[model samples]
Target: MKDFQPQNEEVKAIRVLLHGPVGAGKSSFINSVNSVLQMRMTNEALASSTTSDQSFTIKYQTYKIKKEGKENIYPFVFNDVMGLEEKTGVKEEDIKLALKGHVKDGYKFNPVSSLSDGDHGYNSSPSISDRVHVLVCIYDANASEMKEPVLQKMKKIREAASELEKLYYPS
Candidate 1:
């Protein structure tokens, strides 16, 4: 949302994390949203041009919409993560770490390992602004069906988010 103000002073903007299968248009969606906000076609986040199964995005990146006027940036921000593949893409553990705001921006996705507390990219004490306010799982309608392993990975990520919700909004 443009020019939106949060009721809580601690929150500067809402962070949204977008994740999905490889070539599922995660980056494309970000570009589209930015294009609409800037009123021009621009591809700040590079979308996959190749047909390979590997993910085009390999690092965590945050995208902010900047307007020309006084209200420079929108109150909503987006974080694009590496696409998930059945077996060789982003690991579920890394995604879980990201949801909890442990993974920092520009941190390269290892795929083989998750970010530990001691890692430089790991944020041990993430503030409200650093935490992900929304988790968006993009599903490709063009696909025949979601693979079993990828679906399972997404399920685990969803569970992690749910558990994080408990920590943030405990009853």
Candidate 2:
């Protein structure tokens, strides 16, 4: 993989977006990827189960994987979003904006408020290198059933990713 590199010098890291229901292990997934890349166990991304209804992750965080003993980081980044809830979760509008590369990293999300152009974290014009190239939807297989609203939101997000010509992978 080290030998394989993007042909274009202008191309930066490939951004992969992780999104799913609360407690779906999105953060854990990122940590695992990092661990594998670094060849050791890591807890760089906070991941914990919560009894409360709110999401454990409240901001848009990006995780970079650096190979062991390598000075350069991998040509990829995993972007984790707030876990989705049945009623109170990341706004679909905000997700769409993110898919289109309008949202920036480290942006805090308000469960009750959707992001807009006026937001300080908003990026009016993001280059292709800043856009998400892949979207991964995580789900808990043991869950009895998926909520209708949440399912609908996932579908909308998939559609939005499609509109942005991004890849959508279900996990």
lDDT of 1 at 110: 88
Compared with the true structure, the alpha-carbon lDDT of candidate 2 equals 0.83
Can you write out model 2's per-residue Cα lDDT over 1-171, one digit (the tens) per residue? 665566656668888899988888899999988887677899988888564457888888888887655647888888989888987878888888887788888999888889888789899998877788889999878876888888999999998887667343443
Number of the top lDDT candidate = 1
Which pairs clash (backbone N, Cα, C closer than 3 Å) in model 1?
none
For candidate 1, the TM-score is 0.95
Query: Judged by TM-score, which candidate is best?
Result: 1
- What are the lDDT figures for the candidates, one per model? 0.89, 0.83
